[model samples]
Target: MSDAPGPDQAGPQTQLPDPPRPPLPPTAPERGGPRARLLGIAGLVLTVLFLPAGLVLSIAALVTGVRSRKRARRVLAPAPGAVAGIVLAVISLVLALSQITLYAIAWDDLNGYVTCRESALTIDDKKTCQDEYLPRIEHRFHLPKGSLRQDPSWP
Candidate 1:
């Protein structure tokens, strides 16, 4: 027999090289932008709890949330928390403004009442002035009736 193997005893077969694998898709730098979401939530909580500090925190949240959203858009990600933060900030600001306005009206009404009472010559005149003016002030300020009379010394 020749040195080469016979047909029945074939030599070892050659193995083919593996095909190249496709490159993986690029990953986002931020993992779902959780930092932005957290900041937004923190801002909303602060705004609700403390008005004075809330203004600053709310503004910061807005800025951070906007920046996060822009970055997320570039990566085609969602930013729902940022939108919520902005809405909450606006609501807190409105509440603060309304509270300030109410306090001012209350102060004005009290001052007016005191002035009216001081100008009266006697207890009957004071009573008459209070009866006439208190109702008008309450109506104008949308205060509950007898709100000014809660303290007898107010008259």
Candidate 2:
């Protein structure tokens, strides 16, 4: 036989290169800090819980939420509660403004009731004043008779 293998003889097989793998998906960047998260949480809390100072608190919440979102963007982080805080703050502001408007509209009527209640010395007299005032308030607001009740809760 010759030194080279014949066509029937098997020689060493050539190795093929590996098929290219698909690239791995890129990962999300790490968040920078907790300042934005804290601000957003605080703003959301203030907007929801402290409703007595409605207009002022709502404005404050709005400001903080805006700041939180801005800071988060600057830090390349996500703003978690900032959007909720802003939305609630706007809703609170609208309710607060509507309350103020209604109060202004009912000022004289409310004042008369207040003066009557304050001047009355006896429980019977206060009850009488309330009885007279309730109907008027109900009528003005187009509510059912006895629908609105006021309790001074004084001793």
Candidate 3:
């Protein structure tokens, strides 16, 4: 055989370069803190448990999560996982809070003085009750006489 190899005899070229790998995206949620994510989950859990107070926390968590996501997108590649987590948490929180708020309002409308009475029923009840009760429990804490009005439906 000749010194030069035949086509069939030639092996595949060893010099071929490897195909480049695509770069992976970076991960960073906007606002650079865990606060939004943490608050979101905590708010959701609390909302499920404590209701009224949780509702406030849920609102806070939703607002913060939204702000954080918007901010994170502006600064770097958005962390989709974190965003999703935040969204789920926030939604859970809002739903929880809304449910509780609705229940409270319904309770108020259906049982005019029950909330007030419950507030004043026992010394132990007073300690555990909400501040909203402050206005009803004590004679000194009265709404302005003209403040009473027809119950307004929520929009």
Best by TM-score: 2
Candidate 3's C-alpha runs over 4 A off are 1-33, 80-82, 101-105, 108-155
Candidate 3 lDDT, tens digit per residue, 39-152?
667777777788766667666666666666776768764544456546756687658857866566556443544554455767655444433443343323355532333224
lDDT of 1 by residue, 1-155 (tens): 67887789978789999999998643342422444455556655665677667667666666666776676688776655666655665665676677667667677766777787888899998988789888877798787999977877764
Stretches off by above 4 angstroms in model 1 are 1-40, 107-140, 147-155
Question: Which pairs of residues collide in model 2?
Answer: none
lDDT of 1: 0.67
After TM-score superposition, the amount by which residue 94's alpha carbon in candidate 2 deviates from its true location, in angstroms, is 2.4
Which residue pairs does candidate 3 place in steric collision?
Answer: 30-72
Weakest 10 consecutive residues of candidate 1 by summed lDDT: 25-34
lDDT of 2: 0.66
Q: What is the C-alpha RMSD of each candidate to the true structure, in Å?
A: 10.1, 10.1, 10.2
- Identify the candidate with maximal lDDT: 1
